[model samples]
Target: MTHSSVPAPSPDQESLFAAAAADYARYRPGVPEAAVRLLADVLRGRPDPVLLDLGTGTGQVPLALRHAVPGLAHIEAVDVSRQMLDRARDALAPVLGRCTLTLVHAAADEYRPPAPQPGEVVRQPDLITCCRSYHWMPGPAVLAMADRVAAPGAAVAIMGDGSLWSHDSEWTRALRELIQAYLGSERRAGTHATYTEPRRSYQEDLATSAFTDVSEYRYPVARTWTPAAVVGYLRSTSFAHPDLFQERHEAFEAEARQLLDTYTRDALQEEAVFTVLLARRPGTAS
Candidate 1:
């Protein structure tokens, strides 16, 4: 299992994510109940502990975890996008007083602990978690940053890079045909048939690293969306060629509508399952 380096989001990609913020908030899948339960289990005895959520886009993971673990007090939600941070703030407004929502506008690579004044020392978090955003940073850099910001015995949990949908039984054949027909040979050869093993490779890299007590878990989740919702999701994609092929984009949407019509007549239901990886820093004694 070889983990490919996570690439930084391009300017265009950032624009797409920012533009699709509403859809992302509405249609973006939630963290699986199983994954949320695992996170709660990890933080079971720690009350009012400080937890940092990296790449906290629209604050989905933290919100989900907050629901699962009511005892959690402080969550520093960090993301590079101001628009994303704004949306997250709006979403978590009700609980903003109970929980400290610090929205940091900085890239993952350049993020740093707030500088200590005089003789003061910066405090590391008890737990640091990232969901669906770990793939946005290079693995080595993220690991190093995690090591620096997490206190001894703190946990670093990540869940995503699971977007490859070609593995699912229902869409595999159809997606393959669509890719072949729409994407030319140059791009077609680079695509993966499934996302499972590639995601596992990333987990294996973390598990084998010096980070102690590393573990992995897989959870399944499904969502039902109308064709309009599906189109919204597609619009959010970094690979979507909307500007390059305006006419083709319309055609592809029409084809997708037809496909959805054939499948469900009323609405399209897509099921996605993801693997979650949890790793903890060594205890102080170690």
Candidate 2:
């Protein structure tokens, strides 16, 4: 696999994700049921196949896909967080014995294809998936790696940036204010309250891998939560300011609670809807 030209997230940012792992699993919503259905369509008719899930945070994508593809024989779920891996292991225990569920603890960029021994040809995976975690790696690196790790006709799916919500939503406005106040100028430039733009080249970048018949899908789904749930969800984000300052953390929590109550009519509700991009490698035996 060719190394990605895109740089990984900063060590401090990565640490934030690691610290937020538990909260993320507790409050972070799973993949949408509709997106899972789309993945089922992408993997339909494939024989007992092997799958590699890049950036398999807490194994949500694998869990969702396994539900759709019950006949899958093997799945390798990789992530960088030990805490996240532990949660994934616990969540996937029921199917662990049935299917080969290998939980690899490593950053996606650093992961390498298994070395072949004498007289042994490594088995390339039939399907490769990058769920919400693709943004962490450089796009060029991922495409190059996919070319090397996936079989000739393998299917690769990149699903993320599907978050589409009302920019005018009160919660959105409050969160923006809170981010600006708490993060100051350090907040990512051009970042909006909603997931609007594509973070990377979707079709063109993946096409560089020489995959044929590329396609994309967008699915919309929503989840509602109360004020407390909103707080929990906010704590799950990598940009969460809670851990940075103890006193300020308490103050932020109080402010968030009040803002949520005011905006959500004392209920504090928000929803997230996203699109899933589904693509395939050329020469797939149909």
Candidate 3:
């Protein structure tokens, strides 16, 4: 397709991850506990703190932090994809515990909590988090929106680790080469644009936002994946979505399985570093 003719990401993103929601829910790793603890540390004393998790794919972050935050009474898990929200709803329903969950279908900038009627209270989110999905959003705009709706001294935490496609290893290298042969050398981003690194870093973006004070924490994560899990994970990625493979998907899977077999007996190794940036408005308490 010509550059001018190429589609930009749609506002709703309703169909972006539609085809691979099942695999996404299954293969995407959960947010780590130490990250949750650091996020929770920011809201340690807030009574009945409300959490607003942005791009909350399958409700993983909020689910991980359900009881981590002090009296985390209500959670607003927002996503643009209907399929992911549905999966999140299903995954969170049973173990809600003391927290009430509200699944919102919205782009980050479009999300606003319910307006309080006369004599009612509209409690703003104490912590706003976007994990592994913030780059997909309009960063400045989303942070501006958060400034409008969040409580005084509220924190915004953005978290992510590089994906398997981005990791460097013999198996991942072979896998990337295989995908490049089928697709292209450039990375595919969520159905529309080719992958380009964000011009400004997250810290730089936050530096300009209302949340000026930023602290970054990195946690070491070691993982081993079965070849089947690797295949399933590939299906869920924007770079290697099943739609990109078309009729050759099964054939590719067979080749990927066969290729992974030579890399090791069964498991593929991953050593990743997950990072979280916890930010707040200037003068917000620690």
Q: What tens digits encode model 2's per-residue C-alpha lDDT throughout 71-124?
A: 777777767666677777778778655666666666776666655569955667
Model 2 misplacement above 4 A: 1-14, 115-122, 161-168, 185-200, 266-271, 283-286
Q: CA lDDT, every prediction?
A: 0.64, 0.67, 0.84
Ranking by lDDT: 3, 2, 1
Tell me how far the alpha carbon of residue 138 in candidate 3 is from the true structure, in angstroms, after superposition: 0.7
C-alpha root-mean-square deviation, each candidate: 6.1, 4.9, 5.4
User: Which residue pairs in candidate 2 collide?
Assistant: 4-141, 162-274, 162-275
TM-score of candidate 1 relative to the true fold? 0.79
Q: For residue 64, what is the lDDT in candidate 2?
A: 83
Error of 2 at 1 (Å): 24
Candidate 1, residue 226: lDDT: 70
lDDT of 1 by residue, 1-286 (tens): 0111123344543554565566677766778778888888777787566677887878887788777777776677777666787888888767655766566665565566665469954557777887877765666677778787877777888786355234464643464456447754232211221112234355665765546576778766666767666666655544343443356878887887676566665445556777777787555312
What are the per-residue Cα lDDT tens digits for candidate 3 across 1-286? 0011012235527677777789999999888889988887877888888898988888898777775764788888888777788888888777777777777777877787765569966878999999999988889999999999999989999999989988999899999999989888999876666888888899889999999988889999999988899999998888998888889889999999999989776568999999999998989756
- TM for every model, in the order presented, reads 0.79, 0.83, 0.93
- How do the candidates rank by TM-score, highest first? 3, 2, 1
